[model samples]
Target: MSEPAAEAAAPAADNKKKKWLMIGLIGGGVLLIVLSVVLAVVLSHGKSKKGQSKAHDTEQQAEEGDAEGGGEEHADAEEHGKKEEGHEKPKAEHGSAEPEHTTETHKPAEGGKPGDEAALKAEADQLKQDIAKLQHEMDQQTEMLTLSDEAAKLKSEINALKEKKASLEGDKQKLAEGVKQIRSGEKKCAISGNPDKRLDELRACLGMSQHGESKPGEHKPAGDSHEVHWSYNGENGPEFWAKLKPEWKVCAEGRTQSPINLVGKFGSGVPALSYEYKSSALTVVNNGHTIQANVAEGGGVVLDGKRYKLLQFHFHTPSEEQINGRANDMVAHLVHKSEDGKLLVIGVLLNRGKDNPVLKPVFDNMPGKASEEKAVPNAGFDANRLLPASRNYFHYDGSLTTPPCSEGVKWFVLKNVGNISPKQYDAYTQLYPYNARPVQAVNGRAIVEN
Candidate 1:
């Protein structure tokens, strides 16, 4: 054997052994660092006594580092001697030295690398992040729902405000129209000429009340003319005339009424009617109930030797008195009054025939409005012209036919019918189509013929 070479090989073998031991000590330190990290993770979990598996894993790592030896150290130690090889190999097996190959298998024990428990930790952290994100999204959705409810409420309020604004505008327009009407009415009333003595401007303007109604404290003429307002048909018809005024109760309660059926049975001794009629100015007026013509004081008639002066004459289409239970086309009532305040009416029945010139002016100037009196200055309406040729008549004691029917009045309805044009009949019917009282019962009154 060569002594120098042998000495040099011995130092080389010693250097190799020292190098392997240094690597093993460094690996043990790294394994200890890994154990600390694993234990810290277990403690941080705060699990119960179930953390014993990590301690078992630590003992397994220690045994593996002892059994799976490193390279080059075992080959040099075997060549030296059989006895020395056994002792040195036991030194290598004592877990003081480790191989680079075993270090790679233990890399899973590092903090950031993928290992057994490290993979589970990374997944748990990822789940926590995902849950936090989901919670944040749910919070956002809840906030959006709350905001939507508020928006809907605000919209409803806005709609209500618009409707109120429209209602106010409509009221404003109506008020403006009322104001305009009042101003126009005041301007027209200013010039109607209120009389210095009389306070009513409407009546002073010749009964031409444009409004058809008088104001409070305004005076209206009292009579059957303007006191009680009535018409032929409606609530104010002849049926309700008695109910209109308390003083007109005789119209409904009187035993003897006018306009009885003129069918007679025999002839009693009665004086004939003597008429003293003359031409007079024809003055006509519509008293709302009928067309009445006022005659001057000259006209009159003599019944039973008693003198009666003609006051006025009114007309009725479809004669008020029924002849044989049938009515003619029209009738002219000659109303006369005696000096002693007694009244007697002569009802002359008229049928459609030739035109009589006597009543031409009376129907021609028929007033349209009530209480408006008009005069035909040159119209000479003779009362005798309205009488039928035969003075034979049915006479009875009755009352005034209209409201306020005062009893004890004398009535003479002529038997012979007079002729009037159909045009004249239509002219009167236009103003008063029907204005007659129904035929009343003849309560045992003697109907005598002249």
Candidate 2:
């Protein structure tokens, strides 16, 4: 009995040990398969994360490079603007994040060993989550880089606009200064009251001065030297001369003015002039109105048994006096005054023909500006050279031809005509196109012609 029992017990125990061993081996193989699957999943997730990190780095680098290029382009533009404005360029302040991207780099994790299946599976899932987080961060960085680039572009545009505005302001300031200078010059002209003379003086101050001239009235007191502005045209012209000053009222209201037409019957017993003229230094002046010459104190003429001293002579284009309703090229008025302040004028008609030898010195040295006087020191001018060989003339009672237009003046117009070169006529006309006053009414005055 004991032998049988022992044999059976030993066989059963061996069978049980073999079954337990098989179960242990099978369990180990299943655990290995699960660990391998977890390892594969972890490796795939790591590779995916690494690839994403590399792509993000490449994108970030590209964006950084673009930002750098944009910055460089903006700097060039700023430099060009600075050169145009004649100043130094200012620094840019916006979109300065390129340095942060350059310093950062993504690195993958080291290799790992397989462990329990559940533990490995959990580790792979955690790795996947980490990779997703990193990818999200890279996407955010890329967006930030894009925004930075846009900001940089906007900043560059703003700087360019600022520079343009500054340039415009500078131009405006220059224009303002020029206007101020012009206004100041106009003020000085207003103070002088003699627009032509003041304008010449202003031109001199501005480096554009010209010179040639005459004195209209020299016998007046120094305090009465204020110029009565008048011209041949515009508001201050001859038509308005009567309203310019109280002394010039006769220009518009008085009758018996000089420069009357010598039409109708000629009266008899015309006076012959007796001239006693001396050689003296010649002085020429260009008044605003015409060219004039001043004579020395000794020259005098006797007409109708009365003595009148020759004071000055002036010229007018298209002669002021009309002989029988016809006009000449020019006329010379030799103004004379008697001891009692009576005025007398000798009118000489001029025609364009041969040059007059007597007028060479005065014409050659004509002044260029108003009120300018030039004295010919070494050259002596004879008053008798102005007269023709015959003393026959037409005599009449008239008024002064100038602004005062005072009546009771004696006029003597020579019968013989004077000749002047076409060049001399043109030279005088160039300075004064038309200075002759309009012919006054005869007013029943008698003209005596010899």
Candidate 3:
């Protein structure tokens, strides 16, 4: 009875031992399969992240190259921005798919051995590290995309600037062409032949004006030619003033020009003038144009509440300004200037009649040679005495009847004519028979009378 019981117990123990060994072997095989799957998944995920990181690095380098310079990479960055939307999905898919794979690895197989908690925790921690690495790669990609966008914007601005510069250069070339056309146009218009022509056109051809500033964007070309000297007739005369020197361009362009006709319907109320003049030293000289007398200081005239210091007095035969379309024998222009650089002129029209006591000293002091100055001390000459003993006069605004016909001169012409003997007239005519500029169009200027 003891042998039978011992044998049955031993057999039963053996069966229990073999069943436990089968369960342990099954659990070990399940754990090995799970570990292998996890390692494979982690390796795949690492490779994917590595590929993404490489792509991000390539994008960043391209952007950096664009920022460094050259427009080639700029174009590449733009291309990337348009297709960048597709690239983000891969990273998102990788993050979501990796987690799903992780969850799958974390789950134990049903109807099999239970998983070891410590091993599962270690694998989960490793997966988490891999996920963090993937996240870091995604962030890098985002930063590279931002840099690409900035580079694209900068490239756009650079392109726009390049276009603007080209436009400005084209405009400058057009302006130069226009300037060339002007230079070749009517140069004869520099004179006064065609008064109908607008002043601006003539000025443009010759670049006229004494104090003229160049217009904005204007440039002077090379090989410029200008007539330096001028004469009363022929190529350099008033008819051919278009090609004359730029300084004397006003002869044809001036609106308020000198020697303008005084035949307009004049208004009354001439400004009263007070002359503070006395006899002083005077110099008489023939300046190739007319006899001029330069007087010393202590002589001035006050008109319209402004005082003008006397500069000099000159004569023009057959008075430049016509009175009612009739010229006198000779006209004396006493030039003056105010403190503020304003100019004024007092005119005394002369008719060949009798000897002028006031002018006798000037004739006596006149030199035979041109530019021969003769000083007459205590000449006993006064500007007040030269005017006819009449307060009435004709007045107008005009310019000098000579080269550089600058306007803005205030002229006071005595209505009552003065006298000059035929002998004195002949004496002046011997030097200059036609020392007078022709009367010009009034051009709407007022010829006031008092």
Prediction 2 global C-alpha lDDT: 0.67
TM-score versus the correct structure, for each prediction: 0.51, 0.50, 0.49
The regions of model 3 sitting more than 4 angstroms off are 1-228
What lDDT would candidate 3 get against the real structure? 0.65
TM-score of structure candidate 2: 0.50
TM-score of 1: 0.51
Query: Model 3 over residues 179-297: C-alpha lDDT tens digits?
Result: 67657872343445666654555555543321223221111111111214344554556655535666777788888877866775789877888888877778675544578887776
- Per-residue lDDT tens digits for candidate 1, residues 235-299, read 55667868988987777788898888877585597767788998888768665567888776547
Candidate 1 residue runs with Cα over 4 Å from true position: 1-226
Query: Which model scores highest in lDDT?
Result: 2
Task: Report residue 21 deviation for candidate 2 (angstroms).
Answer: 99
What lDDT does the true structure give each of the candidates? 0.66, 0.67, 0.65
383: Cα error in model 2, Å: 2.4
CA RMSD (A), model 3: 29.0
